[model samples]
Target chain A: MVKKKFAETPNFTIRKDFRPLDVKEKGLVFVGYEISDDKKTMNQFLHYDQLYTIRHGWNSPFFIGLLEGKIMGTRCPKCGDTWVPPRTHCWNLDCNLQRTEWIEMPKKAKVHTWTVAGWSGRSSLKRLPIILVYGVIEGSKTAIANELHGVNPWDVEFNMPLKVVFKPKEQRIGAITDWHFEPADEWEPSPMNKEKERIKKLVEPVYEWVKTLK
Target chain B: MSRKVCIIGGATTPFDYGPTGFESIEGGAAECVREVMRDIPDFNLRDIDMMIYSHFSVHFGHQLSAEWIIHDHLGLVGVPHYRVENGGNTGGSALYAAALAVKSGQHDVVGVIGWETMDSVSQSQGSEFIALASDIRYELMVGGIYPIYYAAMANKWMRENKVTEEDVALIAVKNRNNAMDNPKAQWYRNEHRYITVDDVLNSRLISYPIKKYDCCLMTRGVAFLLVTTEEYAKKVNPDHYVTIDGMGLSSCTIRAGDRLNFPGWIERYGPGYPEMTEFAACRQSAEVAYKQAGIDNPLKQIDFGEIHDAFSTSEAQIYKALGLADSENIAQFIRDKETYLEGSIPMNPGGGLMGYGHPVGATGLMSAIEAYYQLAGLIPKKHLSSKTQVPDPHTGIVNSHAGTGTSISNFILRRV
Candidate 1:
């Protein structure tokens, strides 16, 4: 066979190795790899930028409220049920649903449950043995799972009063991390709202289809 | 208008923790398929009319289009082949698809393979690869690794049920002991096969409430299954004992918060808490499977069980969700060893994910394989091992779940 100036299979013929310079930008992952000219040797390095913007959509206002040091919610005009995550739609399955009205939520809530993690992942591991509490946001059926800080681990109890503490202005951002919960001495107890609309039945065909699956 | 589906034969490679020594995905898959073929006398690749491969991550093995790679390696060029990726339950989901293929009458015989090679990379990389299955926008962005999510669920379950670390430790101990009888299981040869509650409680914690032993080992392996029609099965193996009677697959909302709103749920643990074990998907899938199998009560109807014990806590949660045990007393079931091989309904006779090892994509079919062995009376003759085998298993249920209960598939098999 005649030697050609260029081979048809580019991957088969490894060229000179190329080195990738590090990029310092946040939220971008860069992976580097090199193969020898003989296509016999290879090395690779994976670089990850863990931060990224998560679109909150209709829930953006909820995060935005934290930046303003105000807890916000959306009340269903139809059934008076409120969601602290600030949903655009009503939870009420009945009645002609309308756009929910944005309402400022009470800063105080009660811890429904909590866990003291002796371990965590990359983002939270730095604060090892972090305490996470699932709190029922006061005056709303919505509950938020957030970091419970500034409280003794042994002192934490179910249904204990917790108060949301927004980060300072310099630290504030439109994210779930902009606030954390702390033990609160005084907060009003909200009236028990009618059991937030229970999804009594699954969507048709799904429930019907489950039993008839091939 | 579906035809009856039967499992003619199946095989699973011994699940090994890393450095599997397989060069390519095709190599492991082809070897697994060959092993399955060996189980069915006179069977060959040509008998398969179609193939379905289940694999969750192409990143782990640095391989893509796995079905094509597998089919080419098997030398089944003309075989209609495709791949299914459903997180951890990929195996069972693909098998369900294979059953549908046979039931559709388009093909009487189909091959299903679940293969994953995570040993190609480091353990941390494996964790990251699996975490990709979670909701990237919410769960993954918020410091969520697999163990943290499961730990959070365990925290809620333990708090609500008044269960302690020692109470849940029995699950890990039972499954590990059972693995001693299974040569194919991961810890079958370990000197610490029988870990005590103290061992688990004192072990290094991955995420609080989940110890090292509570989690399934990061393993690499492949499992294969051959599904054929009822008539076709009879012709091939007149004495074949197990036939897949019913299969149910259901998915809940990917967001943990939304999962709590699944129909008729009591959100005792608040948002994201119920998703851990009370996966509406599992309940829905079990309901469908039980109804189709004519099972009124799984606790009594199921002779044995093979559950997705990705974590010991998950198995306990599944036990309650499946109605295999009551919610308030799940710890008692474990404490009493009620689900042990010699218990009322022996579960994970072959050690389950905890013992058999979890190769993600392959774990579901591994459950299927264990259930098949139980229904077919293939217990190996070892005292402690045979005890894990139920006395006479005629009906069984194998549960498969993925991504913190995002996807669930249940298979109901009977020794007909």
Candidate 2:
């Protein structure tokens, strides 16, 4: 199998300055510089940077399946239990570390829970007011969290039917982000309620705030 | 046979210490030790047989093995020490470790010191760092920060239990209002001491249903508690000590999805058991603690509580898990003012995490200290304000939780 190239490594620089040691004693070195304006209340910054290569190990199949437009989960053969975001082994005490086998899950799912996230970590800020849901995919015993598109933040409801939409195979990488959920074609949002209006009002300011961030 | 343990005394740096609180982590820790020593008469650093330190994340301070520096700074260079880290339950876990040492006759006196320096990074970056606590491969990849996770739970919980946005906002208002009486509360440092449900509703939206006011502050502070054997407690400040009667620690799956349709959970807890909406770990921990403390009904037996209200929604769900209110009547429980200062079960009288500020590592110890003060009848003395003091309280519960109720440590303290 050919090694798939990921994104380019971003270039960055670290600021550093050297100064004579203030201590009278010898054999001492300073690695941090004061950043505070007040001399009495000294604050210093020490630069830290590193790159990590994490392994999926036994969970690699789950990510690989995402790239192939398949939702793969694990099943405890002994107990006939299935899981999405596949577990390497059954967590049940009765199963006692029983290794699970991979099983293909259906694209359809039900929204077990959801949130219209107005803010997010720095990387995903551009996707503000995004609807995230923990959906129990068909044939899987556990739910998997992912972004839900094709619905307004206020229109989301409990037990909403959804179907997974995978990225085009050419654009797919072996990651959970390879696919996202969209409202099933047959479903329609209910008429807005007082609660939905309240949420809509609450989320309006978030869009304005996110604009300022840009 | 095990010996009983007691919290003789403790002290904490103001929760709103902010970015420039101290020059270094060691300085902040030493100050806490000094303050604690000064608070307890006849107690000195030399009397501490062992020490346990709680610090949540090394990412914030950019330092590892910080307990070693803290121990050396406190002039405890030769003392045996251990460090405990359990996301947000760091402080409670450290206290539990120290109490076990005293109870099992391993040590006569154990000191629990905890601190967190979160001001080292910007608020956005801090959220990113905290989001890393979630399952990086799955949850974190989808931008699962705490507010989003809690908001999802809040959404489901509110829908299932008929809890409205106003009901959740009431908790924010109450806790922030309660903070006015706590000199060390972060709210005391802010310009706005009083807030209403409308104010909470108007705050900036963090995640849908979770506004800025609903969240706890990122704090930098230190706290230390001294745990001693029952006999040693009598020799020390016996008149002002609270016994550690019962403790319970429990954990659940780090991924919220695992809790859904968990095998045997429904059979054990009935329908909706182990639902992602409620904290099963919290309920389990409370049950263990109540069983040990001989508490049949927490609402009737416990006088007050110091809850880990990372978000207003969490506090309401915790009240149900702690059995302070029934699940069906939770919204009514809050509407009836059952958790107010003058109510039957006053909670977070010293301003919980939402008001007190959560320094992660020190938050649980702060709760424990608040419980200690309440049971020892020193709230007015310690807080310098009598407004939050429970009326002659005899029993109190201190709860410290992490993740979406992934790890929980609960303690039941009683006046001896």
Candidate 3:
């Protein structure tokens, strides 16, 4: 086919109903179309588009940790403040220049606040009733908003204990949705096991830690 | 005591999706300029020293140099044109820029216009575009949408205070009814003017505790305001003008979590609570503005307010933040109708962003234009839809915000 200057791409005026004629044969992306109320003229635009990629520097550990079935946040060594969905530096000005240390959050968390989303934006339409909940990780100082799953909406309550349920290893991706939360049953901690668990927690960093070399 | 700035005249298109000429957004811009010129005799493109245009999410229009497009469409090619964008607060920011231009004496008269074209795409696409204003990495990535975030904030406020869904619904009802009188309002023509609290309560849920009616609609419209030096105002209409008495701007952390200072509720829910000081942007802005205007008390000194009611719950929070009411008495302050037009201090008499329609970029300018009408006492009888109007209002405030209480820009307008 001979490439025509400005003639290769054909433009079609929209009909009164605001529907476009078959342009699939032209191999053009249907960008957008608009119609006037008087129906005198209808305009449509089509063109080549670009998909941009997002880079997560200094925050890759948070995403990588998700794929590893771990929830993580950054801890300010100076202020002893914990941030989920981690940051690279301390939020407080007083703790200036204090590089944040990474810590894997506890699997156990509680619903701090929540909302049942019946509608969502274009990106998450298929994930309706998003059951978005701001959860307070058991050992963290802050709450992180994430999807809550594996329970009826009406059963959810404030301060309800929940456990993280990770996606299967093969299907796991380094994203926030890699794991969701479910209700946790009450545990009557036996006195003997409680002491051992406490000792183990103290010996460990309480959360997995990672750092970047300067 | 810098040079004073006054709004000589303004115009706004009736909030609508479409029915324009081939120019699309440029057509709306032309209409605004034409109408404002018609409103002010002898006013033309030649008098404008500078132009400030407010537009959010340029991708929605699929155009660049939008400010120039509007400027050139008005036949002012060489005129200095600048674009001011700060999410939903774009309009307010543009107005502030215009005021600064006149105050600096760099421009004797400036034209500020705010226009948005969300209707150019589908509603879902529009929502997607708006969601970009939020913390995309954290919020949007996990399926968090714009209205859902507002809904969560509403839930937090209700849980902290003993506010009921009914109270929030009352705000929607009042604003929807108020829109009935505002001929330019988006909901004015619809039967929604008679929407009851139950109607809002029973409406389809967009997010829990926040029904569809509780949220503002994504509208497409344009609003323009002309700010000129006091001397220029005298040249135009000496006796009739609204001077920008005071202005204030402030911003806060993007993370909503950082702003919650509610210890009582956070302890109970294992989460942070909504603290008055946490949402300090608006309060700080209102305080600086009132102080600059030489007003000691805003609740008592200001006659009316055209606040940013992007969501119903935001109105209540703003009331507390602006010192319109104390934490203990805020619910009563709103519930008692003190903010009604007939009450002590009228709020959003023209329905606000809720009833008036929030075309993002145009909302802040819409508030200022509404205040201009109230301060000038020129609000057409037909457009005066509030249950009551502040009698002979001398001063009013226009509150504008970006994200969920992110950036705050306010201007106190007084009849000169």
Candidate 1 regions exceeding 4 Å error are: A1-59, A63-66, A69-81, A84-104, A186-214, B62-64, B141-143, B189-192, B259-277, B381-388
lDDT of 1 at B70: 75
**lDDT (C-alpha) at residue B101 in model 2:** 94
Model 2, residue pairs in steric clash? none
Clashes of each: 0, 0, 4
What does DockQ give for each predicted structure?
0.12, 0.51, 0.22
| Model 2: CAPRI class | medium
TM-score of chain B of each: 0.93, 0.97, 0.93
Give a tens-digit lDDT track for model 3, residues A1-214.
9766863443547322322354234443776888778877887876534534566777878887887888888888998778775768876667885899999888998877777776778767656656778777876665677888875444456677888889998677576777887878672223445424432332232112211111
* Recovery fraction of native interface contacts for candidate 3: 0.49
Off by over 4 Å in 2: A1-38, B264-267
Q: How do these models rank on DockQ, best leading?
A: 2, 3, 1
Tally clashes: model 2: 0
- Using Cα atoms with residue i matched to residue i, what is each candidate's TM-score against the true structure? 0.81, 0.93, 0.85
Range of the 10 consecutive residues with the lowest summed lDDT in candidate 1 chain A = A195-204
lDDT by residue (tens digit), candidate 2, A1-214 = 9988696654437322332354233332445765446565655556554535566778978887887899989999888889998989897779998999998998999999998888888778877888889999988778888999998899998899999999899777677888899999999999999979988998887788778875
Task: Report the Cα interface RMSD of each model, rounded to 1 decimal.
Answer: 10.5, 1.5, 10.8
